[model samples]
Target: MATIPEPANATVQAVYRLHEQRDAQAGHRAHLGASLIGHPCTRYLWLTWRWAHKEAFDGRMLRLFEAGRQFEARIVAELRAIGVQVSEVDANGRQWRVNDHGGHFGGSLDGAALGLPEAPATWHVLEFKTHNAKSFADLKAKGVQAAKPMHWAQMQTYMGLTGMDRAMYIAENKDTSELYSERVAFDPVEFERLRARALQIIESPEPPPRISNDPAWWQCKTCAMHPICHGEQAPLVNCRTCAHSTPVMDGAGGWRCERHNTAIDTGRQHSGCAGHRYIPLLLERIAEKVDAWDEPGGNAAVRYRMADGAEFVNGAPPHFSSVEIRAAKHKAMLADPQVQRIKADFPDARMVA
Candidate 1:
């Protein structure tokens, strides 16, 4: 039997639960942020932008984020004490916000600083980050460019949009209360490269390719959109990912499902129905097999090979040949030990074949 812990005061637990509930209700975002500029995988950014998968954080993680914000405020105060004039808002009385090559991509910078003897009172962007002892030490040693390229990209983008030439990068060690500050110069070449990357992500209809096929790659493991990128979590069932579904040749460019013999309206395609099936291409991309049958169709019943050369017949009585590929693949998937574990918790969690 599992050991049960003794109950403690309910007030703190209640507050944390309330925070989690509020965060969950915040809903999905529509645009990509400049903070993700240095992320290697554009597909991860695309999937997140399209809301293909959901991301969640537990109560403790949420509190950690909140604490980081508070740490920024403390850093700002310390800078002011040393005669560094920092202005968080712009001339119009709003916090400094910036964008990439196109206005469609942007993020709110931490703030901007002036009156620093190092920069001769020019308005230099201020970027603050909180880290633990180990992270803080590495950051201090390597500096922002080598230690945290994503942050470097973000600050550079901010500088490009706001027409600033430099920034004050600040880091605070949460564990030891030690601070490290560095002045980062803007690089026009790196700025253009980051902007081009953002444009590539925006113009592409399909997600960019995954960075690595291996799901266990350290970068992939820490990514927020790892499940969707690796195909571990089934993306929302849709006509785009279904083998039976295709775009109508008509000028209207509508969708249709060959199996159902019915026009698939936009609404139905966006949120797939119960009869949705997986495309063989998608299955193969996820490392699942869709082996072709070695034998020919006999008596109008087509046969297809599944994993390990297991043969399954299509067009046998009620089921049609169009769905044979998906049906066979689904059966093979369920037999896998890993999938069986998931089914233990969610008995109905079969692939939409």
Candidate 2:
């Protein structure tokens, strides 16, 4: 078991403040990076960088921020309406701090609410989420199936930090104008597991990779590393047996391959090669190809024929396969000219792949 960091102070309010600040900083970075990477797509690191730096915001980003604020305010109002004691609603007590790996981590919470008469005097650590009906439906579907690991881990992390046994997710579905309240309970066993995992992440030299397959286009489309991860000309392999297999168009702009199934017009990018061995040589080859494709008219597209006999155009499947290697396309439309320019200007950009 990894050593978990203890709160600097044992008081509920003290721990709450610390965890709140830490979460706030993390949330800020995550949102900023999500904005830059385009939502649903930005990686943790990208979001962190954008959040650390005060960059200019576009109208769309501004609207997103505004909507978030509005949602937060509404959650506060809901808590107040329920007659729960709301903390940190005022300016002075808004910020909190915690000890993280001997360094300081701080953030702010929306506010804490006490549950109603029917429920225990449980402290509700309220988390506000804004989603369209489609997104909400997706979540509900998953919950019906089984709680997602990430969501479970997230709520557990909050529980461990705040020492609260329960939390609530106040989700607003814009399309249906429906408010969905979901309650989550904390398991000490689960908290211990998450605490150990978080300690590992903090102690390790590298960050943990994002490990969800949520079919949200905004999540990947807005990722900063999408160009490197899912760029049209990126060198990838397709295999029928690999778990990452998805039907995708081949380089020839006709015929589909099962090995390449990941390229379907899902409107979202996903992590390919989940089980891929991180080989330097393979990475180098991919970098070289990305570089060649950056040159003027240097791009090529290949049409791949899949075992299913379906016709596909542009890009290969998400996985690498030993059973198939088909045609290559010289240039695909998805490859952006701006990206090519960036590659041309900074040859080292290939290393990012």
Candidate 3:
């Protein structure tokens, strides 16, 4: 028999490349948005904030997103056809959004729905999701809260942010077209707990310890940030990831810097500033020696010797270059008297000591 031909590889490659390019152009988000608020691991949330990079979604995953979107549009159309009033986009052609109390966190809702049998003409937050056959069956059997706490928490947060008391959580099965829905009332207690937890993550200086002690744990194997979070790769530079920075009370009921003893604006916190330093955990594998030193006016420094045998006695070096340049810059910063004075004022400042 003649040799069987393979499928066209070029077409699939083109499709995958297009999706990859789109993913790259989207870039990383600066805020810790609502979708991730209910994730199981606090350490994962912290690592996300510290790194701010999305897991690389392959072509199949990207296509799944597109399918979910199409399903959303179809659901909206069906609702409209049934004389239900659902507006996915608001007056300005934008989705509805809400911010947390401190304005440090926020997210856009899917839509608002009205005239459901459960509510009888009252408006409620419309939260929609699509799942596969097995997942949808589980959702139908257990309902949202019992089967999926994350989705339940997300709806509660939406209600909390929008000051609404009710939300209609809808799920559709992609394979079977089966639909399941439940009206979830706002739980102030749950919302408050989630909100407080998110604030704690944003305010804490160091990330919470890893979720597991064993690197070979099942969860670790599936985690997208496994390499960087586990110290296999260098972490991205940011204030939250810095060794010398911690969030303190700003006194007006918001977060401030432990180092500067002042409120750091949101943008600076997200992207980092001139003073960014890699946290000690991230540097441990690469640093040869780290020492603690005290100066006048109650200041302290965690001096480091790079693996290359160069001495540098300061935090917050610029983008890494040759080991020699970074080491020399660190030495320069330590020698400056102004840097000395600046360090002295922050008695609360700390590092790996």
Query: Tens-digit lDDT track for model 2 on 83-115?
Result: 766665533554422223222121344555675
Candidate 3 Cα errors over 4 Å, as ranges: 1-7, 89-93, 238-276, 283-289, 292-353
Error of 2 at 7 (Å): 55
Top candidate on TM-score is 3
- Candidate 3 structure lDDT: 0.68
Residue 6 lDDT in model 2? 85
Per-prediction TM-score to the true structure, in the order listed: 0.68, 0.45, 0.73
Pitting candidate 1 against candidate 3, the one with the higher TM-score is: 3
Q: Output the lDDT of residue 49, model 3.
A: 65
Pairs with steric clashes in candidate 3: none
Candidates' lDDT values, in order?
Answer: 0.68, 0.42, 0.68
| Stronger candidate by lDDT (2 vs 3) | 3
Q: Write the per-residue lDDT of candidate 1 for residues 1-353, one digit (tens) a residue.
A: 99777668577788789779988777554346888878778778766644455578878788988998998898889889989888999889998987543444778989988988787658898898888999899998899999988999999999998999998898888898888889999999999888888878655555677888789998898888775566434454465555556554354445567767899776676665544544433333333434432223322333345456544333322322323334333456534556546645665444446
lDDT of 3 at 345: 66
